[model samples]
Target: MNAAQIHPLARSPLQSGIGASEPDPDAIVASGVHVIDVETRALQALRPRIGAAFVAACRRMLECRGRVVCTGMGKSGHIARKVAATLASTGTPSFYVHPGEASHGDLGMITDIDVVLALSNSGETEELLTIVPVLKRQGTALIAMTGRPESTLATLADLHLDVSVPEEACPLGLAPTSSTTAALVMGDALAIALLDARGFTSEDFARSHPAGSLGRRLLLHIADIMHSGDGIPRVGADATLSEALVEMSRKRLGMTAVVDDDDRLLGVFTDGDLRRALDEGTDDVRTTPVLASMGRNPKTIGADKLAIEAAHLMEEFKINALIVVDAQQRVVGALNIHDLLRARVV
Candidate 1:
């Protein structure tokens, strides 16, 4: 992927930075503040309007045996797509269907048990009205999200949700700014209400997003990623420094776990320890027992813990490798920073 391009005005106004041309910083800041204020007011106006209709919409969706079909035109269409995705990811099954497509053969995708959520800021979108009668004929339930409750779509709908905003954030009041935001927020409210009703859990979310980082954190355990059996670099506590160096080199983990005769962890020897030993003028390291030169009380993690927790432990201790031990404190596995990187859990 290409590196992100920095915004020209990211720096403070007082800074003498190079740019195409200097803009009025006060005007820029004021414009952003004005937009935010307008949207905030719009959302505030909507809070009091949420009542029976909103609750009814959520109830219908919770009881829906089939999927929730979201349909809209233009800007409302974009928000409708996002609403559908959020609903699907949470717990409810949903998908976006373009209003224009319903006029052709796509209307067949709707079923009798489905709930149709139609969005149109004006409440008079021609494409949606053209097929509303057909969907009604199929005995499908209709939920209208529009600014005008008296419009044809809203009057015909079994439930009407008012996403009306006081005004657009645009100076000329032509673009769909505050209105679109209001509609998006209303969609989120509905999705979350349904999510809570269904008792959705994080594990369920991870199942839907198995390729995402959340899935790795929830499903991947230390045993799944750690180097096990013969892959672990280890040496007996009585082994010579030369023997430990040979084990570390062969395993390529940059460290070796020092264990006793019963395979219990005792200490650890690393390349850093080797350097420290040399600086101490221990020239006889070749024959010296590794226990005398190893670092005592090395950090270790249980093999049953989550991989992400192991990652946090490594980061907190500023170490690149961790020894995985069983309940008996016997070395069962080993892992390095590169292993977490390869697993994409880092």
Candidate 2:
């Protein structure tokens, strides 16, 4: 890999503080690149011969009504687990089933509606074949991924996806490296193809992953956990600063919504404002109206937006809170960084 060439505007040996004894940058980059070269060679090896077989594999997964049961042995098992996760996180519902365990009665996990994605570089794994007959009897479709097109696993599969590589990236030729990476990428390709075919939106992905940041971004709606009704700390803009401070403390959101008589969002008065006001050496409870210290035009977001969008907006503006407003600019609810954190949006 070539190192990024420095531009004339940014080039200067003085910018580099490395001592003269430091190793040559070319050798340093090449040392790391040699490993990448091996992996690249393997992926390049998969690019060819991906004709009808890849299409068959995708069709098998697309026709699947039940979850995709991924099974494999050894390092292939590790790769299978990741493929299963990718499938599940995308559109396809999937879970990893250990082949060894499947032989020990876990084969019961395979249902008639499910589709099997079996992995084995050699196209043969004794533990995997043990349950193959049962899967066949149960009417479950099988999709095989292997380096050998003529192997038993491929022969038994309803659809065979050839993931052959000329050689392993491992120096010993014993470890599974490039082959496994190819399998992983192939699995990802299948998953994304299915995701696109099914019109799997990020919102759908978030529903499947309600615990992750993606889930928070997609599944969360303002109406689901917004500070609404009376829990919303709100006060009229003409209210005294003392009144606003009481509302902020009582609401415990570190901020108070400053609204007009018609509930239109006039501005916002947060703890930061209070601090700044007090630091200006004014008495904490002087006759200053809440409107006097509030932001004239506060940033706002819609209630239906993904929480990730809200976080991005807040981050870009260097603000901590955002008021949820309607089409008419009426304040419906409000939230801050901590709310997003608690909701796992961050």
Candidate 3:
């Protein structure tokens, strides 16, 4: 078959303009590089523009008796929402309110004590413009983030933050490309500056994100999820395999901590060890002492350690369970993979 017949789906099956040649791989990569370079330059240019107005915006947020109400339209609205989230998580109380929604009685959410941060690339978005008068009537402070400092919104605002970029990264220069990036970066700068001024600690961040993985790492302690006292499945070192197996089966943790008479863990015996024993052709498995079959110096974690640290220990050692020890290295509790999963720390 000819090449045209074999590749009927080819762009230029007929060698006409019906299908143009494929875009060059280098050109595709260069296009992305160009966009990034443009956005990088835009952010660099914005650095010099950070002056008194930006500091005043942060001071207003810090002084507000109410929340920071961030409102915007279109792509600017998306950036507004992210900015609000960053602010809220970094010790500043903030939330996003769609400008269109604000015109329809949602405006009540903004009070005199609140500071309204309005975002618009052109500073002339009709939805944002419609609510500016109402915000003024309510005696609420206004902060404007826009590419046009001379626009009506900027003129009406108590503080105007100039976010003008050299040009849009979009080839047509119509899409909100570098402009939106500039706004987002400025929002992040404000949030981080406020974070530093407020002395936001990691613990404060964990509280704001209590359901996230970082929260689990920072807030969940081993003691919070471990099985203590009677809940632990422990067998004496001198106990027979049958007794240890019974303990494991009763606890259903797939393993048993082998301990001494003083309740100090001596070692551990798991299903894997049992399998190894059976493969070694040991006769009368029930008669074997747990001490003879147990693994010596098994890995353990302290009760005061983070549960995520315990998870890392389990993964690094390729084990399913760990004995929880006190500061003195005496076993006080026990936990397994299921415990970590239940605590949402895995």
- Which candidate tops TM-score? 1
Q: Report, for every candidate in turn, its global Cα lDDT versus the true structure.
A: 0.90, 0.83, 0.89
- For candidate 2, give the lDDT: 0.83
Candidate order by decreasing TM-score: 1, 3, 2
> Can you give the lDDT of residue 328 in candidate 3?
67
Taking all chains together, the TM-score of candidate 3 against the true structure is 0.82
lDDT of 1 at 297: 88
- All candidates in order of lDDT, best leading: 1, 3, 2
Q: Is 1 or 3 the stronger prediction by lDDT?
A: 1
Estimated TM-score per prediction?
Answer: 0.87, 0.77, 0.82
Better of 1 and 2 by TM-score: 1
Writing each residue's lDDT as its tens digit, candidate 2 over 169-242 gives 55456789889999999988888888999999977987888887777777887666567778788899779889
Which pairs clash in the backbone of model 3? none
Cα lDDT tens digits, model 3, 187-293, are 99999999999999998999989999889889999999999888888998789888988999998888889887878878999999888887888687689888888
Q: Residue 217 in model 1: shift from native, Å?
A: 2.7
